[model samples]
Target chain A: MLAAGLLALSAGSSAATDGYAAIDGGTFRSVLPAGPGIEQVDVAPFRLAKTPVTNAQFLAFVQKHPQWRRDRVAGLFADQSYLQSWANPVVPGAGAPADAPVVQVSWFAASAYCESVEARLPTWYEWEYAAAADETRTDARSDPAFRARMLSWYARTADTPAAVGKGPVNAYGVFDLHALVWEWVSDFNALMVSTDSRDQGEDPDLLKFCGAGAITMQDKENYAVLMRIAMLSSLQGAYTTANLGFRCARDGDEP
Target chain B: MRSIRRLLRAMAASCLAVTFSVTAQDLPDDSVYQLQVPLRTQADTASTLDRWRGHPVLVSMFYASCGYVCPLLIRSTQKLDRDLDAAVRRNLRVILVSFDPDHDTPEVLAALSAKHGIDDTRWMLARAEAGDVRKLAAVLGIQYRKLPDGGFNHATIISLLGPDGRVLATTSNPSHPEAEFVAALRATAVASKTPAAP
Candidate 1:
């Protein structure tokens, strides 16, 4: 009976590893409002990879699922530049170091990799909630110093992304949420919409967006987070950028 | 009873075999139908994005409870249908998949189809799982976000797909359907009627 129970536990917790850290979630006040009259989003507890997915990890994924290889992937799922940094279809050499976060990846490719590991891309709210922390405090967005540090990273351009886990861990014990690469969220397309038609009053663009008003920015001063939202919203599923990468998340209580 | 169960099992196995063969043989690598998403139509029938594979199709995403613009989307499609020649119309299909699958059940989709007065023979209203809905929207380049009021904010886009499921053209202006899009639809429909060129 004990052996059978152990087998079931191992099956249920496939991605259980030291690399994944538990994030205790709660009401998070994101820069973008959840919707009309909804200022705070209720995020559920989940596990997030301690660092961004590395080139080596993604190399393993493509080796297993040849359809997702840089050459074999369909044009409908990824653009031509997808995995352009890799040395070859199966090799992540030189420019794409094994320890470096995988860049030039489309949302579809990133999601497929996460699914291969029995995980999924974190939702926008979950990412924001986890990213809102510093080394000391969980909700450190109010701190000018924290905001300044994050802004500095955005302003600095680098030819290649630094290795993951090079920065300090956050209050949630997760690293490189900000200072690494711009990550992909599952609902990247759902981030922004034009302002409500009712507010504009007989605007010609009303027909463009249907139903309730679009999401309005709550914290206008939070430019770092706002820029991330802008970049993500502008991307399509098949688009791949030079610095775009992703990490995986799992649902249910962290074990 | 034993014979009936065995017969049902055999039928199910044959259906699975047919599905696998279609997916493996005919689908193009870049076709939106490459997405293996299952959908349910207004008639409570299981369907897929490739149901009208051999014919030109007009596809869009909308929520059944959408108050204002969704109805306009339906009218725009109907106008496009009316603009086409009867012969071309007979060869074209219209599919509107719901972004809000939780509330837009098969029954709700059927009601919306009736309310719009669409010809069920050529027009299909369908709903897919939430994850599949997102994937379909991404492939169609449609954007949608759910509001706190349970209503969705979404783009109004109708895409024209060739007989092979590759996107041919798209129009976002529901108020005024583009003549170019109509012409493209007619061209694709007429082309589909002809035998393949060597």
Candidate 2:
């Protein structure tokens, strides 16, 4: 993401809450990128959930809504493969509580939950920052610090489902960001496409994310920046990972 | 002088207003609007988006191992970078997030970022939690299905997010032209700085 002003901007539809994000002008200027459609997502400072959405919270939503429950709303989530595993209740009971984060949800389902609560998903950047934050830490489980913390957290508890406990939060005061289950974000396809809101009228040839052909490069440390951008982009919207879960964000009293 | 200040502010506001389309009213039932996607922390992750919170961003998605779509996507990204207004480019940061966390190792991601002359400053490759991946795909209106080959058969969609991580607009694949991205950059160029609270 790049740094910009706090002014309101409109790309296409003018229906939701909007705000300006920032970027590191110097860093952004120093490097070159793959072919160009990209969005510099601004991740403003805000409260992030301590842990991944748990089964309990999901159960609560299902219980109250009834419509969102697995039995009630069939075929509303991930591909059948993902659905199948979750199809059988891993947990004995179905009703979930509000304190736990929701699980077994697809991005599609998470998004709907956020919307119903009048909140939105965090951009991957924001989620990552909250989940694993070290001026130097980038990804989770891989980072020694992150991994160590996760191991310790897990060590204290059994593999069985559990609620988050009181613990130190990140620099931003987000709870259980790293040790808990993975949290969902809004910008998953950070590497694959070139997207722009300002240049709606520009020619069509410049967009980068529309599907690039192939990329083969090796050398590691020397290319971390490029790699970072591309890695985020490489993801698709259909992915389903057991570790992944989600949280939501909301604009100040705008609705 | 007052008029000039107003002009500058107006120009900046207009820039944001022109590019930032999301409002509280637009976002409703966020759940089930699209497919159920999953996300995981990438093996090799990049810098934080917090670094770019206040700037316009150009983004793309691709796996390092992709034989075709990934390459084309990088090429397009390069073309857009080359074509962006110098001013917009100065204020812009372009990043790539990978979908394949398992294979997109830090080394693989770095090499992929570099193969196309991408440097760390502006361009990058990061990982996503499966949940985050799904939510992002939905917001951008992108869809994909895993292929038997351990790859994905996903639509190509280009997206722009305001400094605040809000979706500005998108360009679907098979039709992304370079000029569109440049225009997106321009839309965000004049806004006042959304510098992270120091």
Candidate 3:
């Protein structure tokens, strides 16, 4: 019995789901608004990619050539080629590590990959929970220093994206959420503070969107944040880039 | 029983929306409007496009009605803004060219910025005519279509324009965290003489 138990323990370690680094923070409990769209997403403690997706991982998606990849036939501009380039498979000769996060993938490509793996991309709130990695402990939402440091990587020589945990993952099992490639969230289009579509009579369904975790109490504060989410949401799967990447998530049991 | 039925209905609806939100490729890119505008920008207003000479520009296209993707586009631009220092911020500016020409006026943009408190002074929201909007979209290989309900079925193309206004990097979804814009900006900055004004 002891021998069998030991063997099982070792196997569990090998298959252990690593990636969650729960931040040392609070139980920010709140209720979702009672509306048609808002719903509670009890994101049980989970793990996420601490860093942005990488070129190597994206290369693999290119081989798969999922529906997201649009072709770059000559003379015609490659529409969002970066997202699909990996989906397009550059040399096919290039070898990629399966464990590496996929970069240059649009929210569509990333979402599809997560679905293929029997998972899903995280909500913007969940991504933040992981990215904040417990930094929700601090009250520095407007720290200019933090924002500056996040962007500092752009000025450096990113010959190869540094390995995960090169610096650190936050409280959540996620690492490099702040400094590496921009990550794609499941509700990557959902913005917290404001909505531009509501201003223009684009659709009566303007406020009625899919993938909202909550009917947020207040509008989001920054167009900057709205802009980021918009960019992520607008992309097709065929896109990829040196800096764009994505992480994965599984809907954990309700917390 | 009625409450349970309502719950089930909401669940079904949420699933359907999530399905389309996560899985669909049908978002508008408006490639139909290819290169029809003069492709002017706020940068052009402050100085000649020649200031950067051959530097590259990262451009974001959006309309006011798009409560969903438009915010994402702005967020992506903000992400690019987040990566820049004050000096680089000065050299690299994210262009927000309004597509909801019917709604996104200069005053509207200024109000939105004031409302949202978007910081990067380098980020400018340009107001233009719908025809010019189509032309600019064409030149940069961006796509957008006016929706039947007045919403747009638009291409979410964010391009890195060479300072000479040559298109450099065209990012798909041009709205996410803007990794393409960030990378293209860095690459363009390195590849330019003066680099465009902040």
Query: Residue by residue across A66-104, what tens digits does model 1's lDDT show?
Result: 667776666778899999998898998899988789999
State which candidate has the highest lDDT.
1
Worst 10 residues of 1 chain B by lDDT: B16-25
For each candidate in turn, the TM-score is 0.88, 0.39, 0.39
TM-score of 1: 0.88
Off by over 4 Å in 2: A1-42, A74-76, A81-101, A132-158, A191-239, A252-255, B1-198
Q: Write down the DockQ of candidate 2.
A: 0.05
- Tens digits of lDDT, candidate 3, B1-198: 223333334445644322211111221232222222333333334322223333345675777656676776676567656666544555565566777778776667767666556753455666676534543554454544443245655556666666555565666643342465567666655666664554
Model number with the top DockQ:
1
Tens-digit per-residue lDDT, B1-198, candidate 1 = 223333334445644221111243245666877676799999999998889988899999988888877887888779878877766787889999998989999999988888889898899999998878888898899888988788888887888888888888889875566788767877874588654333
Provide fnat values for all models in the order shown: 0.56, 0.10, 0.00
Candidate 1's DockQ: 0.33
Count: clashes, candidate 2: 166
